[model samples]
Target chain A: MKKRLLYFCKSFKINFDELEIYDKDFIFGVLGVLVEYLSGLLMMFFIYDFVEDINGWSLDQVLFFYGLNLVGYSLWSCFFINTITLPYYIQRGEFDRFLVRPESPLFQIMMDSFDDDSWGELVTGLIILCYSWIRLRIPPIYFLALPIIVVSGCLIYLGISIILSTFSFFTIAQADVANITMEVKEFAKYPLTIYPKVLQIIFTVVFPIGIVAFIPGMVLFRQIPWQLLLVIPLVAIVFFVLSTRVWYLGLKHYGGTGT
Target chain B: MGNEIITVNRLSKQYHVRIITEGNIIKRIFSKKKYKEIDALNDVSFSIQEGQYVGVIGNNGAGKSTLIKLLTGILYPTAGQVSVMGRDPFNDRIKNNRNIGVVFGQKTQLKWDLSPLESYDLLKTIYGIDDETYKENIKKFVGLFEMEDFINNPVRSLSLGQRMKCEIAAAFLHNPSIVFLDEPTIGLDVFSKDSILRFLRSIKEESNVTLILTTHDLEEMNSICDRLIIIDKGRIIEEDTIEHFTERFTCSKSIVFCIEGDIWKDINPIDNEVLIVDNGKVIVSNVRKERVNEIISLMLANNTINDVQIIEPNFTEMVKKRINEGD
Candidate 1:
């Protein structure tokens, strides 16, 4: 584990240097993150003013859920925005260089940038999360649940991205597939209870975005019978392992050269 | 340098494809189709010495790149064994990679958004080179490649020739004992090609770096390579020293002259093929270069010679003739 940590650190250092190479690219990345945060907050405000509460939950509870998703998306974007462009890189044959390196390509792509744009969302997410926690007057045990939720959310998002990007190995037109995956993931922005029960079940079992947002909210709202926060880490680990397996399966089918 | 840095025994690779179709919505959902397998590499075998500059010459789709990919561990061989530097290239790649430097002419390994210097530094970190040693090597390569003017420029902005030089430099950054260059001089101007080839030759002479070069330009083979292998349809048709290959396969030498009389046609020399005839002009082919003087004497005996020229077959023409002969 220590050796793996050391390797990850070195790889991250390389990625940081790559990030610093383009000053304008860094600026644009930061701008993107900030814009995403502000727009999310604005949408949350409008929804709160009109709906008052969602599914018998108060405004603070919905804001807590929104903040949870914000934290989730921010963390995911922070680690993997660069990886989203992987299909383009694959088409240009640039990804071959990454594949030949000793380190795993997934790690290299994941750590490719610091993602300054996600910082805006991250800061706002923490503030909203803290504010809603105060308004709800949740106990300290739920505070312990926050990190679990965030980690699981990142895994779910990353898993989806990997499955979508893997389509590049087989498809000549994968842009539409990428769009549809992200668009469907956007459905998880709302509370799962607000969705149909079948979709709620589907999201819980198949996609598991609820592990990041809804289940954590259930623990805070005291809606579930037991403390469900413990399940977050298990889901994160399982989903991450499966995503990595699928990624390797896709790579095995990749023909390394041009058509 | 010994005679085997790379050894291959019956290497082959095959790829399978599943056919999918778009019919009516229901049929598209339910239909299953046949699958096909494409054999990209056949049971091929070869070996290279440690310091020999070997060139692989073949037409396109001859599995040249596939062979390189298999040997470099970028792709797995379906059957047979390929050992580079005494390690199985596919199974134990990282250890094997430590001793080999590879350059793909069509692709680059450098960080796309980084400057050449930054990418080189990053490689220095990954390769675990001491800072002082890395600095010395970087200085040497920068000077050799004339990359000082653009070392700070992002790789995306450099010209093709400059980027090619950087790619070559990146491949050698770790100082590997074996260097594989696949069409390293393709699409470069004469000046750039000359510099790269000169640097490669110097590396061979100064260090015991084995070079495996693949290019369609046999002139590249003639100038830098001592050994040659010619492949067609995933099989090596010819392999020998450059001199022997030239002697056995090169078909003709040409002689040109301006006769004093206007006897353009029907001038015969002993055991020579008349290839060109024009007003006050005559040309003969298939004569040995050693018989140039004799042919000149015969031409002068027939008519006063205004001028004389002798031409030996160049490497490209010889390779073209070999291909035609093989066909």
Candidate 2:
């Protein structure tokens, strides 16, 4: 595992260093992340101005949920946004480079790119999370658990991305299709209780997009026991492993049976 | 011969494809899936010795790329087996990949924004190459390929030939034993093709790396490859030493008889191809080697001939024509 991590680091370093060559585009990309974050926060503020809360949670609590979404998505975009390009690669038979390499193709694809935009999102997320934490007078020690919770959330997003990207092998899907589930993530930004019961069930049991932040957020908001946080991370880990299996099977379909 | 670097035993690859004959857009959208199985590659068996340079020649859709993919572990064989250095390439992909290299035509593997030098550094880390050997190989490649001028320039800024030189160098940076080059010279200019082929030949002479290249450039094959494998319609029709294949293919020459006057219909029917008139010359193609003298003597006795010529078939055209004929 150490060797594999080293390979990831090395692969990532090359792509990361490309930022220096095109620093202007990198700056604009960072600004794009900020633009996206500010727009989301503004929309949340607009909604909260009309009422105190949608379903028991206050504006500050919703802000926390939004911050968690940004943090998790930012981490995922940093390493795994390149997955959106897979459909085109599969359609053109350009994925050969990944398999011919000595390391895992999944690892290679994720590390082959570094989205500079994610750095801006990460910074903004921590700031909002800290601001909300102080306003709500949550215990300072809870900050210690923030990183783990955010990482778990990131893995869940990564898992979904992998599963969606694998569909390209059979369907010859485009980038829009590969990221189809991401539309649900927009709904996930708010508290899950705000939605209808059917959607809540779908978010929790079917797609599990809510497990990324809402289930864990329950403990942070003091609505659930601290022990529940442990189970959230385990769900992310198990889901990620299962998603990888689906990805490999899709690869077999591509190379073994068809182009 | 040295040890067998790659051995493919009756390997085959089959795929199921859907055929939608619906001409109407709505019908096509709602049409049921109708699948037909195709044998992309079938019962192919061959072996390559260490340090040998082999060329796979074939027309488009002749399964050349499929065979290369199987050997490189990009595709799994449906039947039979393939062993690269005693390891099944598909089942042991990572292990086999560590010992081999591949180059696909018209695809630049270098990072677009990074200089070739920086890309090499990343490859060093990926392959876990020791510092000394990496440095030694880098210096040698730079010097031999004359990449010092653009080694520090970004890959996007370099010419196709310069980029290809770097790409090939990157593939060999780790000193892999077997390198599979799939039409590495495609879309290159004449000078670029010449330069790339020259570098490949020079590299093969210095190292014991087994090079298996698939290309339509017969002149390149004639100059660099020691052996040739001709694949046609999912099967290898011919495999032999370059010298023998040339001799065998050229044995049946095209005999042209330049008559003083027109005698287009004077020749009697023969078991071989009948005489035909082209620009006032009577020619009989596909004439056997031994029967050349006998037929020419008979024709001379029958008609007045000003000149007689035996033209050996062109290697490149003959290969394509033969494969297309088989198709």
Candidate 3:
């Protein structure tokens, strides 16, 4: 694991050096990310301004959930956005290069590229989370668990990304499916109580997007039992293990054809 | 011969390729998967001793790439066994990979945006190379390939030949005991090809690294390889030392003689030898090596010969003749 982390850092440094060659483009990319982040925040504000409470959840509580979702998504983008390129790798016969290496192929793929644009989303999310925390007057004990919660949330995103990208092993045209599935996770920005029972069930058990942010939001609001917080780590582990299995299965079926 | 570095016993690889149809989406999703098995490699077996330079030659779809992939553990074999350094390549890939280097000529393993030096540093970390060994290998390769001009340039900015040099250098940074090069000189210009071939020759002379190269260029093989293996239709059709392989197919030689005047009527053809005269020249075919002097004397005795030339069959011709014989 230490070696893999060191390798990932080396890969990131190489990418950063490459980005330096075109400083203008790098700056423009960061600016575009900031605009996108502000737009998302504006959309959340627009929805909250029209309603006093969404399913008995206040604007402050929902804002916290939104911040949680952004944190998870941005962290995932920073680390694992390269998973989206899995289809291109398979189609172009680039995956064979990974197979020849002595390290884990999955780790290599995850570290292939780093999305620097996610830094904007990460900063915005942190600001929002701090504001919501001050407004809600949450206890200091909960602060200790915030890091754990954020990491677990990112794990859920990582697991889902792995599962989605693994589909490319079977067919190269799986990027659309992966994109749609990822977009669907955006619905988790709101409280799960407002959605239909079926969707809530699916989000809890099938996709687990609700567990990523909504449950943590409930904990912040003091509406759910603190014991329920343990579910975050438990769910994250189960999801990670299951997704890793799927990834290995996909790898086993990789034919490396067309080259 | 040194200890065997690679061994194969009845190795085979078969891919289940799906045949897609322009059917309805529902049918495509619900119907049972349909596949046609294509044998990329049949029951093939060979062994390579350490420090030997072997060249693999085959036509397109002749299983050259598949065999290399199997040996490198990039693809699992469907049957039989492959052992590299006394370990099963597929089952012990990480361990087996420690002693082997692979280069797919059409592919670039270096990061496009980073310099060769950066890529080399990344590999040094991945392969756990000690600083001393890393510095030694990098300095040696950079000097040997004369890559000082572009070693620090981004890989994307480098020409194909330059990038290929870096690629080859990167593969050798770990000082692997065995290396596999698939068409390493493809698409290279004459100068670049000469440089790469020279580099390869130097490596062969200076180190104990075993090399297995696959290429369509028979002349490249003739220059560097001590042994040759020819595959056709997913089977190993021929394998032998380069000298023996060339000797077995060179059954006849052509001798051409230039004459000052027309000698067609004076020169009589010998039995079991073909003789033709065209435009003040006498052409002799199917002449044995030992009979060259006798034939030359016969021609000189009858007609004045100005110039004489002898042409031996080249590697390409020998390969063509061998494949045709198999067919």
Top-DockQ structure, candidate number: 2
- lDDT for each candidate structure: 0.76, 0.82, 0.83
Chain A, model 1: TM: 0.84
**Local error of candidate 2 at A157, Å?**
0.6
- Which candidate, 2 or 3, would have the higher lDDT against the true structure? 3
Chain A TM-score of model 2 comes to: 0.92
Indicate which candidate wins on lDDT. Answer: 3
Candidate 3 local lDDT, A1-259, one digit each (tens): 7777788888888878867887778788878978887887788779878888877888888888878777877888788877777888877878888877787778788888888877777887888888888898878888878887788877888888888888888875545455654585577777888899998998789778688777777766757887788898889889978998999788777744433
lDDT, model 3, position B3: 94
Candidate 3's C-alpha runs over 4 A off are: A172-174, A223-227, A255-259, B20-34, B257-272, B277-282, B289-307
By DockQ, highest first, what's the ranking?
A: 2, 3, 1
lDDT of 1 at B290: 66
Rank by lDDT, highest first: 3, 2, 1
Per-residue lDDT over B154-190 for candidate 2, one digit per residue giving the tens place of the 0 to 100 score: 9999988888889899999999999999998887899
Q: Provide chain B's TM-score, model 1.
A: 0.89
Docking class of 3: acceptable
What's the lDDT for residue A104 in model 1? 66
lDDT of 1 at A142: 65
The iRMS of model 2 comes to 1.8
Q: Is candidate 1 or candidate 2 better by TM-score?
A: 2
Better of 2 and 3 by DockQ: 2
